[model samples]
Target: MLEMSNGSQHQTMKLSKNSWILILIFIILLLFFSILFFFRSKPEYVSKVDIALGTTVKVVVSSDKDPGLIIEAILREFHRIDRKFSVTDPKSVISQINKSENPVEVDEETAFVIERSIALARATEGAFDPALGNLITLWGFDRINDSAFKPTIPSDSQIEEALEKSGYENILLENDVVILNNSVKLDLGGIVKGYAIDRGLSIAKEMDPEATGYIDAGRDIGIIGPKFGGEYWAIAVQDPRGDSGEYIDLVYLKKGAIVTSGDYERFFMMDGVRYHHILNPKTGYPIRETISTTVISPDAMDADAFSTAAFVLGSEFSAVLLPVLGGQGLFVDAQNKATYTEGWSFFKEKH
Candidate 1:
């Protein structure tokens, strides 16, 4: 009887070991299925595509979608449309509709930019003007590559000449046709990239309604939709110094554009002082008093234009001016103190 009892206990111990093994296997399988379900329910992702355009263009899109092919097509179309208005020799376009003579015809892309520029100029009361191209070129800010050399300050006479040649009033656009007076020259550099970013986002949205993406064109950026797991796109504000990826702060953005303009971005040092690219339309001198200005708006064009305008307007006026112009802006003075409009706080990410 003692031997039989000992054998029964051994058998029971073996049975208990097998049961535990089975339970462990079942738990592992359950966890696997849970993870699989979670991922399957989540949206698929796509790789980022870098597009080079005026200044620079880099975009990040959904992985499930082909950003490479899509960006290529969009860029091809943009150039094709831009060629009509562009003068290859001068490498610029005339974007005014004149009443005195037959208006120059522009493609859909150029026409759209002209319209946007006109609207922004009117809204800002000449704070953001495409006609500032001559002044930009004079200041050497029109170079395709960001130049590190400081341009000699233009004399008062040169500024006067540039000012005479620069004005939105010199441009005329009617029914998709644009004309420019002899003295007027158009430079869409400030607003065109933002417009293209918007266009790209529009295409991406059409392709996948749920897809989230962002476009970074040098300092101009636009975010569409939310990030994976329904998070906002975190954007880093780069430090103006040459150190790459040195971010001042990370801003959470959704379906909006953030543009920054600063004196430290592209400039050369002369005798221990830095001379940057952004020039004031009024004085034809590099804008001072503010280190940087960032503007966030529903439209990339508005954000781009306003950021530059706020920089030009200086810190004191920008605080009051941006709201009157119907936008939210942030100004960082030379001392690094940040100030923004009342609406700018809503976009800040809480730690």
Candidate 2:
């Protein structure tokens, strides 16, 4: 009887030991799976930041794979480049061009922009000429301060004089050297930001080819790649007369440029009407018939020029001009109607 009792006791002990071992193993597996589940649910963080440009300018950058340090370095370099090319400063390249009798030699980057400007001028039939500096200054658009609105309409004689100096043909670029007529002046403000955005994007791609990035320079924007895990960067077009932060519509872009020109952004009221900065090459007055126009193209310079050109051309002419220039445009007419190119529909969002 004692032997039988001892045998029963040993079996019970063995069964208890086996149960505890199985329980421990199950608990460990449960803990491991819980840890993995927590990690899987957590999202990968990307940096979205607002970078200041000088005291008056500001831009936003969105990146999934790029480090903040890399983005800052790129922007710093851009600002440095801007300072070097700034026409507002008397010591900048423009001053050098004005003072030099011989062709002024510029850095590769500046040379590229000047070349692009020349190409745009030829492409737009002188509609997007960079030699409008004299006219721009005459209109007081060159002033940095938003002082009391100086409403001085240029006389026909003044316009004629400015026109004489306002053609890209007056400036010559040969063998990477730029020579400007003493009367003609250069201002790349309308196109340089877009070009710089492209340059910053190129740098970002070089740093991380697989990384997705975006550059927004107030009016000009460029996308390096899609947002993380997506194939397109969704962008919103701002309403010209609406609240500052409000948008009219969203568009999806993969690899392209978008630029908008709006009269409401910068203008002065005269005799119960507003006068914007865009000057008609012919009339020497702000282009009428459109409140704003936005252009999208494979190149930023094209987009930058086309946006302004479409505004100046009006809906009737832009409808023909945009397609001919190999681009798509969105125009907001004086009646507040929105019209877009046939190609623009491909980039429209599905509600």
Choose the strongest candidate by TM-score. 2
lDDT by residue for model 1 over 1-351, one digit each (tens)? 112347436432334677889889999999999989887753444444444444456666663566565555555544543443332224445423322266677677677788889888877677678877677777676553544634566788998898888878788888877777656677776676677778767877777666676777776887857777378877777775437788776677777888998887677666787777777767767777788888888888788888877887777788888887777888888787778888777777643
True-structure lDDT of candidate 2: 0.74
Q: Which parts of model 1 are misplaced by more than 4 Å?
A: 1-44, 49-51, 63-68, 74-102, 144-151
lDDT top scorer:
2
**RMSD of each candidate relative to the true structure:** 6.3, 6.6
lDDT digits (tens) for residues 1-351 of candidate 2: 112346436432234677889889999999999989887643433444443332222333344454565577667767875776666668877768756777788877678888988888787777777888888878777663446646666788988888777777888887778988757888776677677767777777777676565677774687767666366777788887788878887789877788888998667787888878787876777877889888888877678888877887787788778988888888999888888888788788633
Q: Check candidate 2 and list the clashing pairs.
A: none
- Clashes per candidate (backbone, < 3 Å): 10, 0
lDDT of each: 0.71, 0.74
In candidate 1, which residue pairs get closer than 3 Å at backbone N, Cα or C atoms, i.e. clash? 45-63, 45-64, 46-62, 46-63, 96-172, 96-178, 96-179, 97-172, 97-173, 97-179
- Cα displacement (Å) at residue 63, model 1: 5.6
